[model samples]
Target: MDPLTLGSIVAIVTVGVLFSGISVAAGLLVVSGGFLIVFEGFSALSLMPEIFFGKLNNFALLSIPMFIIMGAAIASTRAGADLYEALERWLTRVPGGLVVSNLGACALFSAMSGSSPATCAAIGKMGIPEMRKRGYPDAVAAGSIAAGGTLGILIPPSVTMIVYGIATETSIGRLFLAGVVPGLMLVGLFMLWSLYSTWKSGDANVLRATTYSWRERFEILPRVIPFIAIILGVLYAMYGGIATPSETAAVGALLCLVIAMVIYKLWSPTKIWEVLRDSTKESVMILFIIGAAGVFSYMLSSLFITQSIAEWIGSLDVNRWVLMAMVNLFLLVAGFFLPPVAVILMAAPILLPIIITAGFDPIWFAVVLTINMEIGLISPPVGLNLYVINGIAPDIKLKTILVGSLPYVACMVVAIILLCLFPGLALWLPDMVMGPEL
Candidate 1:
């Protein structure tokens, strides 16, 4: 078959399989399987072990499982509740205070938890019900958690950053630092939007909840101090040249577990075992997808498809900003259908070189790409965050979550635009902290 026909077939089958409800790993595995056979005949079956291990045999990727365990440890504890209640004490006087507090909790939890869904699950269980009970609108309550949860992937220790760094061969530390400013900017934007929506609609009534005294505020601090330390310790370890990302992840996980078991008294043997098992299962699933994408990328390389597309993009005479916009647009749409990791894996090989050639800093592009990924987390039709919140509060209609998320989604778009305009937001922190990437 001609290249166009063959390419079309691969595209159709891959997307069809994914939309059919199979996991992303399964979808990529099928695609890679087909291309491997199509290109190399039956003898190619011998390469499975090499492909799988080769893709996963990276030092940096080791952080993924460690971070997963750390997040799971926190999730399996009272950290989520503590974080929310602590933030609520301070934020409860603001308009739509619960929503704002939920966003604050999600942000702090994002610092602890690198995965978006985990952030959502941990925060949603507490935030949604409390806000709903206090007379917050279903759409706003659910939407806030779903949108706020996206911060997990934008903050440091982000699993998405690890995958993106590995895929693009960027520095994971730099990627982590690059996310800090933009992540905070997005947080502010979300909070501002929350305040505006609540004030405009008079739902800011959450301020009516009993305001905490200074004593009460200080009392809640103990429950939150450990998590604060976890966030600061990991950031310092990575940014202050104390450890590699993998080492930092390992230390973070171990410390979090110690606190959970000894200090918080939240983790039992069964809970520890469950956390380990769940982390291992998730890590394996992600690794399989990574391996399959490696194979699929190789096939694209062999077919000259990626090179041809890159050359075609480079040939365009338009200004580079237009092309960057198009790339962001593509990512925004694709992220709705594909998980952030899958989108990063599939696009990195194709997009990174072009982005570099266009004179955009890879670090800035990574943050921008991540923001697009964040937007997808709360989007309609297939937003995983929406589904997660729905699972926690089954009475809240999915449509409510989806609608409520639209305002926060708009805030995220503003964030993406602001990042585009001021690449400094993404780059300055890395430059200041690490003295710029070579």
Candidate 2:
């Protein structure tokens, strides 16, 4: 079979298998091995060692576990619940008061967790019930938390951002910093949409919103201030030249432990062990996926499929803006079917070259891509966050969750466009904070 035809076949088979409910790692292994059968065959079996072990040898990857530990530690404590309460205190007067608080809690927890599903599970456990109690339409309450939780990956300390950085060889620190503005911008977009939808649907009028006095608002600060400290300290330390990304992760992990143990008073061995075990489990799964995708990416490179794909894109000679738009659109659609991290692994190798060749800022594009993945988490059928919210929100239909989150998807799309139009929105903070990229 011709190379193009052969590549197409393998790609389709892998995607089809994914939709058929196979693990991504397993699907990629089968696809990569299948690609070799058509070309390199048994001779390339030797590449297995390099594929699995070599991909994970870097010091940078250590941050995955540290960050995971940090997230798990915070989740194990009352941080998520405290964050929601604190936000609720402050945002009660907003149009979609409870909904806005839900988003706010997700955003704050996103700083600690850097994971969408974790954020969803943690915040939605509290946010959804509170919103429902406040007379929020079940769909809006469910959707607000479901969609808001995606902020975990778009905000700093994000595991997926680290993956993208490693995949693209961009600086993880810069990428983390780049996401700051875009992440906040997305929070605003989501809150604005929540306001609009709540007002439009007239749900805002009936919902209960407690107007908090300044003294009452001050009472909740202690519960949430420690979290803000951890986030700022870790990011600023990394970006202000006090720590490397790995070191920042370590500091964040340590702070998270302190918060969980001393602050939250969960000094028991069982709780500590559980948090570590959970962290280890998540770390192993993500790292294994990374290693697996590495092998698959290597196979694509060895076959020169990535080169061929890049050349083909270049040959189209489309305007760069047009290509960027097409890429974002493709990512948006791809989010419907593929999880964001998997899409990044496959597309980064194949498309990053084309994007870099066009002289677009990769870090900027990284934020853009992360936001696309954010939308995917809430999107349908396979949206991990949707299931997460559903699990937490009993009696809430998946259909309602999906329908309610559709407006937030528009927020993400708008974020992508604004980032594209003003790459500075993503780049400026990283540039100012970290200076010129090395």
Candidate 3:
């Protein structure tokens, strides 16, 4: 059989088997990757060594474990709970104030945790019950927590950015720096939407009319200062060239550990062990996916599928904006059924080259792709965040959370358009800070 047909068969089978949920990880890896090797013979098997070793030897990949450890440690601590209390007092005066405060709290926690599920679990445990008790609708309460959860990927110390940087060989430090402004922008958009929805619906009953004195507001600073310090230390060290992105992550992890132990008093030897164990498991899963994706991508390239696709795209004479709109449509649909990491791993190889050939900056494109992926997290049929929020609030229907996420999805669509129309919104900061090295 021809190599192209063999490669196409391997690709289709791999995707089909994985999505089918019948094969376990080891089985899928061996079956999908092994079949390609067996059919293609020893020369193709040689690529496995490169793919395996190349993924394992990456120094930047170290950040994955460290950041995961940091997020897990912080989530296990009481600091996150305290941060919520502090934010609630300050933000509760406005309409849908509690919901808005939930977004604010999640954004702050996400900057430290950098994992959406962790952010949702941590905040949902606290915020969901509080909102329900205060007469907020279930959909509103669940939706806000779910929407706020996505801020994890946008904020600093983001695991997704780390993965993207490692995959594309872009500067992780610059990606982290680039994400800050856009992350904050998304948070602001969510807040405005929450406020408007609440005001129009007159759902102000959930907000308690509480006032915080200057001293009280300042006192809560002690609880939040550690998280801020962790974020700043990571970004500052990276920005000042004192540390590589991986080293900065290591530093952040250690700082998070120390703070959890001394400042927050939540660390025990067993707790530390647990955090490490869990982080290792998660890291291994991600690394396995990366390795498999590398093999899959290699097969596609060797078979010339990527080249063929790129050429096909290049032949098209559509307006650039229309092309972008089409890309968004494709991603939005893909996100409904596929996991974000899988989507990135599979699509980045094909679409990224087309995007670059079309004169779009990869850094800017990363921002756009991330926003699109964020929509995937909340979109129906397989929306991961909706399921997570539902898991937390079992009494709330999935439909409620899905309906609530629509407005935020609309917000994400607007964000994409803004980034497309004015690429500078995403590009300018990175350019200024990284100095035009694209």
Candidate 4:
């Protein structure tokens, strides 16, 4: 068979296996192992152990767990609630501010945790019920949290960015910087939609009457500001060349644990244990996928599938913008079935060369690719954020969550278009901090 034909078959079979509801890591290992044995015989399988283990060897891998620990520690405590409440107190006077507060909280918490589900669950628990209690529509409340959770991957200290950096040999710190402006841009778009939803629902009068005294607003700042500072400090350390990604993550994790214990009284052994246990579980899951992806990558290379496909795409006579559109479509479809980290691990290396060859900045494309992945989080079939929102508000109906998140998905698409047109939205901060990519 031609490499292209065999590659198409492999893609179909792999997607089929994943869509069968099997574990992603297991599905990848099974598909890659079967293919290698079929084409290259059992002798070729010997490389599997080294390839899998080798994925974990990078110094950057340490940041994954440490960042997870930072997220897990805050998620396991009342920090999410406090963060939500803080935003709510300040935004009470503005029409539709409650839902807007949820988005704000999600963006901030995403920077802290860098986990989409964690951001959804943590903020949704407090924000959704409160928004509903204050007469926000179920779709509006649930959708806000679900959509906002996607910011987890687009914001700084993002695990998805970390994975993308490692996969494409891009700098993790610069990737983190690249995400900042685009992340804020998405938040701004979400907030606008949220306010529009409020006005459209005729709830502006009710929200207008709601007010918090200066005292109430100021009180919560101390609790929330420290966490925000931690996030900023981590960003500064990495961007200023003060620390490597792993070192920054380690310090940020420790600070988060300390703050959680001090402010939320999360000092009990059980609480601490839960934090550690959850972080370990999530980190190991990501690491396993990376290992499996390494083997999967090797299989494609051995069979000449990667080169053949890249060559086919390169030989196309399409404009660069058309090529980008096609690539975005492919990433979007892949994202529906695979989580962001898995998609990045499996696809970024293959796409990076194509993107650079087409005269696009890899750093800028990282933000665009991430925004595409964000849509998948709220989309159907395997939209994890949708499920998380449903879990938090079971009575809201998954369909409502999906409906509410659609506008936010549109916002993401718009962000991608803007990135394509401007490019600077994702590249400016990174360039300012680290100088332009060579």
Task: Report the lDDT tens digits of candidate 1 across residue range 91-188.
Answer: 87777888889999999898898878988998998989899888888988999999999999989889999998898888999999888998999899
Best by lDDT: 4
- Global lDDT for candidate 4? 0.91
Model 2 residue 272 lDDT? Answer: 94
Local accuracy of candidate 4 as per-residue lDDT tens digits, 1-438: 899999999999998999798999999999999999999999988999999999889999999999999999888877789999998888877788888888999999998889899999999999888888787778888998999999999898899999998888889988988898999999999999887877877854436646689998899888888999999998888877799899999999999999999988997999899999988999999999999999999999999999998899999999999999999999999889889989998998789889988999999999999999999999988999999999989999999999989999999999999999999888888888888766
User: Quick one: ranking by TM-score, best first?
Assistant: 4, 1, 2, 3
Ranking by lDDT: 4, 1, 2, 3
Which segments of model 3 are wrong by more than 4 Å? 1-12, 22-39
User: Which candidate number has the best TM-score?
Assistant: 4
What lDDT does model 2 reach? 0.85
lDDT of 2 by residue, 1-438 (tens): 555665787678888878778888778877787777768878787887677788888899999899999999988888899888888888788777788888888998988898788888988899888778877778888888888889998788899999898888889988888988888998998888887877877754445578889998898889889888999899878867888899989989998898888779989999999999999988887787788889998887787777777888888868999998889888978887887778988888777888888888888889888888888888875798899988997699999999888888888878887877788999898888768776
Better of 1 and 2 by lDDT: 1
Residue pairs of candidate 1 with colliding backbone atoms:
none
TM-score of each: 0.96, 0.96, 0.93, 0.98
